[model samples]
Target: MSNAADLRAKSTDQLNEQLLDLKKEQFNLRFQKASGQLENTARVRQVRREIASVKTILGERSRTA
Candidate 1:
């Protein structure tokens, strides 16, 4: 998990790409859970929080700009 400081250091475009990747992983995790193929259940929550963090950082940048 990346901390706020690390996320803040990233450019907005990099953050956006990261957010998109996390969203895709979230979707795949959901499918894996449904198919009973998911072993790392905790990852779902981690990804969710990561997505939120990226969005929060993006929002902060937009507000500041």
Candidate 2:
């Protein structure tokens, strides 16, 4: 998984786009799990961590500006 500090370096709009993309990926991962097609279960954790990273960035930005 990519680090939160790296993810937080992007602009707000970029962050939003990334967050959206990640959510889509997370959905797909969940679908795969349901279908018994998922090979890497750790992916779900990675997606979750990324979501948390995005939210952390958003929160920090809001408090600063």
lDDT for each residue of candidate 2 in 6-58, tens digit (9 for 90 to 100):
88778899999999999999999999999999999998998998898898889
lDDT of 1 by residue, 8-58 (tens): 999999999999999999999999999999999999999999999999999
What TM-score would every model get versus the actual structure? 0.97, 0.90
Question: Model 2 off-target regions past 4 Å?
Answer: none
lDDT, candidate 2, at 34: 97
Which runs of model 1 end up more than 4 angstroms from their true locations? none
The per-prediction tally of clashing pairs is 0, 0
> What do the candidate models score in CA lDDT, each in turn?
0.98, 0.91
Q: What is the lDDT of residue 10 in candidate 2?
A: 88
